[model samples]
Target: MSVSSLALAQTLLNGALLGCLFGSIALGLSVKWGHLGVADFFHLSLTLLGAYLTYSLVTELLWDPFLTLAVTVPAFFVVGVGVQYLFHLIDAQPFTTLLITFALFIVTESVVSMIWSPDLLNLRPLLADGFTTSIRLPDPLPRLAVQPIDLVALVCAALMVGLATYALRSTRAGRAVQAMRQDAAIAETLGVRVLPLTLAVSGLAAATAAVAGMVVSLRMPLTPTLPLQWIGVVVVATMLGGLGRPLGALVAAVVLMMIQNAWSLWFPPQWAPAVTFGVLFLFLALQPLTRLARERITSGRTA
Candidate 1:
């Protein structure tokens, strides 16, 4: 390949890896919003919480960033369960639930700002550093080197998504949860424990957020405001990916990231977010028509 072509290819690879992390973030939101029918506006808050907690622990106790997950994952899971219970008690209207969680997002962001400020905090042991230090890709791409840590993070994300998909497809609990999404009352009548199942799903969502946070920290600097960015991108991914499918989330993320990277490389940096939103708009415009055609085809098949 020519130099420019090689560079673009390398950039795309990096983008895909980053996209996997983004997809993982969306998985949690998809479960809460798509499957449970909960408006989990605060899903990104758990990610920010994990990021800041990891930062604090590493700074204070000198723990490894990977090791911090041992604490943050379970802690966030508990927090998620508590949040779900609170939502249940309020029996909130959809808008009210959305507003409450939006407010919670603001509160969490404010707290993060208070504790860590808006300053960018870079985690030590960045996988990039090691890649820059000792490794080089054989490709003729200028300044492109694959890092071991990057590979590790990408593999972990892929594995997590795979396991989540398998669980959703193969497990009894997974079937019950899927049934709940389709018809909550019917599922409850069939011996599904609604409350506990919801709690478990919520906890699982939080744990996913935690894992995403860890991967993100390894790859990029953490900022108090970063979670806000995640909320938007993840919401887009979830909606475009059909919400409950982990594999769909992964594909959506890769597509979005490729679009963003290609746009920014060939065009202006400021246009990247606009292009991402444009892709989302296109997807929204097409989805209903796609659904209608599918339904018509099914009707014809049955006829």
Candidate 2:
């Protein structure tokens, strides 16, 4: 069976929107692991909690969905800082950080399950007719469906990535973050308050996760185990783009997600996941050769 051009365009559009959501989801992990050297797997758990909280507020308290960010963002920022402080207390090594965060992820998941009962909750009821509202492309192009929530996720992703890129490039704290990444001892010697900077970054990372979570609830349902499903793609995007590179992660996620979505159009749905990991594997396989080529180029220049 042949697919229509319009169908393909619609698929691509959905992929792009979902890609932004996934990219935003991975940002917290990217920032924490990339800059601070803390893997912080609990970041996803915090997102799940945020999504559930948003659902509760929208359903129980009759608050607007977007307004939920006002609560989740600050709350999760504090949670992120507290978790970072615990890491500081332990002098968390790479392996230990991973293990500790994994444990914390489990604990947080348990808390959410107990509170929310592992149910699939969403803001659909609160959204009413707004959920189905779509933007139609003008004539000369096939009509493509776009949801308000999708635009919300895309905007949030762009803002988070842009703000992060700007902060890292234009702000003093960003330079200190870069310095710490290069050498914490040197940055500290240069009078950078390394500890406070890390706490602040951690808080920001958690805030992004909260924003991501609220965006997610606007689009999808929340379940206690949802993070498990997300962890793979998020990690792939994070590693593919490298840690601390939010913009890179977003680009990687969008590309990977689009490819995966395209694959589903022609191939079995079961094989769709292979498209994602296969791309990652291909990149990993090429990375060493790319590194070697760069080294040779540098050597030739020196010669």
Indicate which candidate wins on TM-score: 2
Global Cα RMSD, each model: 2.8, 1.4
For every model shown, what is its TM-score relative to the native structure? 0.90, 0.96
lDDT of 2 by residue, 1-303 (tens): 798888888898889889999999888889999999988789998888888888889888999888999999999989889988998998888899899989989998999989989778766766868665887767776477788789888999999999998998789989999999999999999999999999999999999988998888888878888988788788899999888899889988888888888888989978887778888899999999999999999999999
Residues 84-175, candidate 1: write the lDDT tens digits. 88878988666777898899999998898898888888875533355335356666644676656567567866887888899899999999
- Candidate 2, superposed: residue stretches over 4 Å from native: 140-142
Residue 94's lDDT within candidate 1 is 65
- What's the CA error at residue 116 for candidate 2, in Å? 0.9
C-alpha root-mean-square deviation, candidate 2: 1.4
Best by lDDT: 2
